[model samples]
Target chain A: MAWNLQSDRPIYAQLVEQLRRMIVTGVYPAGSKLPAVRELAVEAAVNPNTMQRALVRLEEEGLLYAQRTSGRYVTEDNEKIMEAKEAMAAELISGFVSDMMRLGYTREQTIRLLEKKREG
Target chain B: MEEYLISCRDLGKSFPGCRALNGINLELPRGRIIGLLGPNGSGKSTFLKLCNGLLTPDRGELLVCGSRPGVESKKHVSYLPERSYLNDWMTVEQMIGFFKDFYADFEEARAYDMLARLAVDPAKRMKTMSKGTKEKVQLILVMSRRAQLYLLDEPIGGVDPAARDFILSTIITNYNPEGSVVISTHLIADVENILDDVIFINSGNIVLCDSVENIRAKQDKSVDMLFREVFRC
Candidate 1:
C-alpha cells in the first residue's frame, strides 16, 4: 500500500485507497487471505491501530471480511471491488481537476497535461 | 471471562498537603469502552495510573482482571502515559522491538505495518519526529498489544481535527471486543459518541457512572452540553 507523507488526506484513508487499488489491480486477489494486522503494520511503518481502522473501514465498505481468529480476507465479489475503485478514482481525479481549474488552469491545458502524463 | 475488569474499594491517595483521590470507588465491567472524564487537577489521570499500577493507592484495594496490581496486572494492562515516555534516542523500529521484548502480547508485524501506513519511518529517530507524529507512534505501539485492559491518557490531546478522528477510529477498531479500555481525557465531546459508558469525575469523586444511553435518557441533553454544565470552567 502507498503511504504518501505529503498528502493532505489522513494516512488511514490513504492506506484504504492503496488497498482498493491493489484489489482492483488483482494484486491481492479476491477471496485471498490478507496479511495479519501486525505484519501489515510493520511493513507500513505505522501503528497497528491505524491499520486496524483502515481494515474496519474496508470491512464496512464490503471490500473485506473477518473470520474469528482466522484474520481478514478480500471479499469474494470482484465486481463490487471494481465498482468501489472506479468511484474512488473518479472522485479523486475530479477533485484534482476542479482544483486545477480553480487555480486558473484552462480545461484544454488540464487535458493536455493529462494526455502528456498518460503518454509519458 | 472475569466478572469485573476493574474493581476498586474506597480507593484513595494523598500527598503531604493534598488529597488527590479520596474515598473513590468504581467498578468497570469487561468488554466495554469507558471514558474517565474530569477537569484539570481532578485526579482522572491519577485514578487511571492507579488502576494501571503506575501509582499505588494510599488505602483500599484495587483489582485489575481479578488480580492485584503486580507483574500479572502489568502484563495484562497496556498503558499510554499522558506525556511522551519513549526514549528520544530510539528509532520507531527500535521502540517496536523493545515493546516486543517487554510485552509478550505485543505484535511486531502489526506495529510496523501501522507505521508504514502512517508513512512513519522506522529508521527515523523519535527525537526528530513532530509532537503529533510521536503521539501517533506511541498510540500504535500501545494499541498493538492484545492486552486485557488499555489505559490511554488523553490520546487525542493536542492533535489536529483530522488526527483526532484518526486516533479515535484507531482505538475503536483495534481494541479487543472482550477487553476493556479506560480512556482518560477531558475532551469528552470527541469520544462521547463511541463510549459505551461514561464515568464523570469531579474533585476526585465519581459523580456519575452509567451507560451513554442511560445518561442521555436521564439528562435529556448531549454529552458535550452536560459536560459544559458540569465543569463550567
Candidate 2:
C-alpha cells in the first residue's frame, strides 16, 4: 500500500502511524520481515534515521522484534496486534465524535447517525 | 575524528556592497539529507558555494570532511549547480564520459541505469533535449558519484512537479549513508518530508538549524509553514 504522509506534522510520528496501520491491517502480516531501515527510508522518501526511530518505537510497543543479525520482523503475538487495532479504532472513533460535535450534533444525535450509517 | 561531513566556524563572506554570509556556525553529520532553506538573497546559495569551493569565505572557515574547502575537499564533493554546466554540443553519453574521466568516484553503470530509467536518449545532444530532460541528466551524473558530500543548489528550481518527484526519488535512492547531502532551495514544502534536518538562513546569517522531527515537536507546524512564519516579510 502507498504510504501517505503529511508535511504539517513530524514525519517520524506519521511513519509510526502508517506502519501501525500496515501491521494491524495485515499488510505486513504477523511474523513477516520488515525491509531494512535504509530500504524503507528510500521507498518512503524519508530519512533513514527517522525510519529507524519509527521501527524502534514499534519494537518498544511490542509490535515488532529484532534479531541479532538478520533484522527486524513483525511480532508473532496476535494479541498485541489486536490491541493495536483496538487502540487505533478508539482514536478514530474519538476523532469522529469530536468532528460531529463540532458540527452541532449532540452526543445522542452523533450515536444515532453512526448507527444509521452502519445500518445503511 | 571525522564527525562532521561539513562544518563552519564563524564563516563569513561578502561582496563589495552586500554581505552574502555572516558569522555562520554549523555542523552537519554524515548519512543525513539536510535542507538549506531561505528566500532569495538569503545566503543559501552562498553557503553551498563555499562548501563546494566555488567561492571562498572572506572571513572564518568552512570545512568538508575535516579539511578546508579546496582540492582535497573538492574530491569528496559532488555539486549540482542551479545552471546547466554541460557543453551543449556534447551528447548525453559523451557528457557521462566526461564526468567519468574527471571524477574517480563516478559510477558509469549507475549513470547508465539512471539515464535509462529517465528514458533519456544517450545519443541526443544536450542542446536538443528539453530543459527538464537536461536537468535530469545533470542530476544523474551528479548523483552517480559516490562523494562524501553532495551539494545541490536549487536542484528542482525550474523542473515540473513530475520531474521534481523523479529528482527527489533519485536523490533518495542514490544517497550514500557514508556521505551527506545538503540541498539548497526556497521551495520548502516540496522537499520538507524527505529532509532529515533543516537549516534556515536569512540576510547572510544562519538562523535556525534543527532536525525536522524536533522542529515539528516544538513548533507543531510543518517546516514550510514554520519557515513562512520565521522569514515573514
lDDT scores in order: 0.81, 0.89
Runs of candidate 1 exceeding 4 Å displacement: A1-120
C-alpha-based local distance difference test score of model 1? 0.81
Could you say which candidate leads in TM-score? Answer: 2
After superposing candidate 2 on the true structure, give the runs of residues whose Cα lies further than 4 Å from its correct spot: A101-109, A118-120
Q: Please list, in the order the candidates appear, how each scores on TM-score for chain B only.
A: 0.96, 0.96
Tell me the deviation in Å of residue B12 in model 1.
Answer: 0.3
Compared with the true structure, what per-residue lDDT tens digits does model 1 show for residues B143-228? Answer: 89998899899998977777776666666666566788888998876776557678889888888787665666566666667778
Clash count, candidate 1: 19
> Tens digits of per-residue lDDT for model 1 on A56-107?
9999999999998999999999889879888978998899999999999988
